[model samples]
Target: MDWIDWGDAPTWLGAVFAAAAAGAAVWTLKSQRDQIDEQRRFIAEQSMNLGLERQALLAAAQERHEAQARKIRLYPQAPTYVQVVNDSDDPIYDVHCEARGMPALHAVELAPSEGVGAGILADLVQGASRPYVHRLGVGREAWFHVVTNERGAVHIRFTDAAGNKWVCDDAGGLHEAGA
Candidate 1:
C-alpha cells in the first residue's frame, strides 16, 4: 500500500484549496450580511407598527378626555336659584332651560357671575327672559332664579360653536342632542 504525502502535493492542488477556502469565506460573509439585513428590516417594521399603535391610543385617550371635559351640570343651589356651569375648554351658546312645570327659559349667556350679589343675580335671572345670543366661556357659570310653583326637575340644552348640541337632563345625564 502506498501512503499519500500532503507535503509533496502539486502546486495546482494547493492553489485550488486556497481558492476554495476564499470562496467559502466570501459566501459565508454574504450569508451573514443578508441575515443581518433581514433582521434590520423586521425591526424597522415592528417599530413603525408600534408608532402607529401609540398614536391610535393617544387619539382615543384625547377623545375620552374631551368628552369628559365638555359636560354641563345644572344644580339647584337654592330654592330660587339654578346654577349653570360650563366645564369645558370651548364656549357654550344659545342656552335654554326648562323645568317640570315652568316657563322655558332662554338666555344670552349662562356664564359665571364673578361676584355673588343680589343685583348681579337679579340681572342674570332677568336676562334669561329676553331673546339674547351670547356665549358661556370655559369654567364659567350663571344663576337663574325660578319663580315657578313647580321646580322639581330641569332640563338644559345648548350648543357649541361647532353646532354640536348638548343636553343635560334632570337625571344628571349629559349627552349629545340629536343632529
Candidate 2:
C-alpha cells in the first residue's frame, strides 16, 4: 500500500477558515445595524407620545382658567342701577361691561371700552359692585339684555389671577380675550 502526499493541505484549510471568519464578521455587522435601526424607531415613538401628553396638559390648564372666569355675574336690578357679583374665590381685575347689539354683536361703548368705559370698573373689583346703570333704550332699559329677546347680550371682560384676559357673556358664552 502507498501513502498519498497531502501537499499544501494546511494552506488550503487556512484559506477555508479565513473565509468562514469573514462571513461571521459580515453577519455580526448586519445584526448590529438592524439593532441600531430598531432603537431609532423606539426613540421616535417615545418622542411623539411625550408631545401628545404635553398638549393634553396644556388643554386642561386652559379649561380650568376659563372656569374661574365664569364665576362673575352681571344683572340689572332696576332701570337706575345694576347688580354686579363675583362668585369666585379670587378677585378679578379690569372688569368692563358693555351691551352688545343682538344682530351685530358689537359693544355699544366700543369707543371707550377700556379703562374709562361706561358701566365698567375703574379699579379692580373685589366682590359685588352696585353701579349706576346707563340708560339703554333697547330692551326696556335692562343692564343685561337677554338672548331670548331680540336685544343683544351683556358681556364682561376681565383679567384673571394668572394674568389671562377673558370675555364672557350672561348667556354662558366664554372666550379668551387677546391683549
Candidate 3:
C-alpha cells in the first residue's frame, strides 16, 4: 500500500498555504472592521434624531406652561367699581381701563396677587382729576373712581411682564389681545 508522502512535498507548497491563510485572516479582519464602522454610524444617526425629538417635546411643554401662567380675571366689585385680578403666576404691567362714557385710566403694574379697581369703589378710589399709575403687588388692590354712571360695558387692558397684551371686559371675560 502506498501512503501519501507529505515528506516529499515541496518547501514552496508550505509557504503557499501559509500565505493563503494569512490573506484570509486579513480579509476577515477588514470585513469585521467595516461592519463595526457601519453600526457606529447608524447609532450616531439615531442618537441625533432622538435629541431633536426631545427638544421639540420640551418646547411644547414650555408653551403650555406659559399659557397657563398668563391667565387673568376681571371681577365686579359692586355697583360702582370693578376689579381686575391676575390669576396666573406672572406679573402684568401697563394696566389700562376704559368704560362707556368715561375716560380711560392707566395703571403701572400688577403682580400675581395684585389687582386694580375701576369706578367709584370704596374710599380707596383715587380721584379722576389726577392721572395715577398704580403698582399693585401680590394680593394688593388699587382703586380708581368713576365720574359718570352710564349704562355700558367696561374694558381693561394690560401687558404682562413678558410684554404680552391682555384685555378684560365687564362680562368677566379675559383674553390676550393681538395674540
Candidate 4:
C-alpha cells in the first residue's frame, strides 16, 4: 500500500478486450444456430424412417393369410355344381360356398343347396375336394353352387390354418375378413 504505479499501462488494451468479447459472442450464436439446424434434420430423418417401418409392417400383415387363401380353389366341373378343392398342406375350417348370378337348372331340382348339410363344412383337409351345388346338387361341398357367366359368381369363405377368416372370390382374389 506504500505505492501504486500505472504510468506504463497500454492504452489499446481495453479496446482489444472489447473486440474479443464481441467476436466471441458472434461465434457462439453461429454455433448455436448450426446445432439447431442439425437437430431439425435429424428429427425429419427419423420421422421418415418411422413412416417406412409402418408401411412394411402393414404389408407383412396383409400377406400373412394370402398364402393359405391361394390354396383354396373352385373349378366349374358341371352346370349344376363347382368343385371345391383344398390344395394346401393344412386344413381349413368353416368353409362356405355360394352361387351368385347363376342361371336356372331346367333339368334338375333347384333348391337352396345345403352345401355339406348346412351350407357350411366343418373342415376340409389338405388335397380334399368336394362338390358344391346350389340347384339341389353337389362338389369337393368339398362341392355346392351353380355355374354363372358373370365375374365373381362364386366365392368361398373359410377360416385358414391360423384361424384367420378369409374370402376367395371367383376372380381368385383373396382377402382377410373385415378388411
Backbone collision tally, model 4? 21
Per-residue lDDT over 12-91 for candidate 4, one digit per residue giving the tens place of the 0 to 100 score: 56678889999999999999999999999999999999999999998888776577667777655445455567666676
Top TM-score: which candidate number?
A: 4
Candidate 1 clashing pairs, residues 3+ apart or interchain: 111-141, 112-141
lDDT of 3 by residue, 45-129 (tens): 9999999999999999767645633465555445555556655565556565666746444223334343343333323444333
TM-scores vs. true structure, each candidate? 0.52, 0.60, 0.45, 0.63
lDDT of every model, 2 decimals: 0.66, 0.53, 0.57, 0.59
Give candidate 1 regions above 4 Å deviation: 1-69, 101-113, 124-133, 147-152
Residue 128 of candidate 4: its Cα lDDT? 29
Candidate 4 regions with alpha-carbon error over 4 angstroms = 1-12, 101-141, 145-151
For model 3, the local distance difference test gives: 0.57
Which tens-of-lDDT digit does each residue in 1-179 have in candidate 2? 24644676788789999999999999999999999999999999999999999999999986786776777665543332233455666666655565543321112221112322344322212212332222222112112222222123456666766778877765667788873
State the lDDT at 168 in candidate 3. Answer: 67
lDDT of 1 by residue, 18-106 (tens): 99999999999999999999999999999999999999999998676447335666776555556677786677787766666463443
**C-alpha RMSD of each candidate structure in angstroms:** 6.3, 10.3, 6.9, 9.5
Please identify model 3 stretches exceeding 4 Å from their true place: 1-70, 104-134, 147-152
Roughly what TM-score does model 1 have, to 2 decimal places?
Answer: 0.52
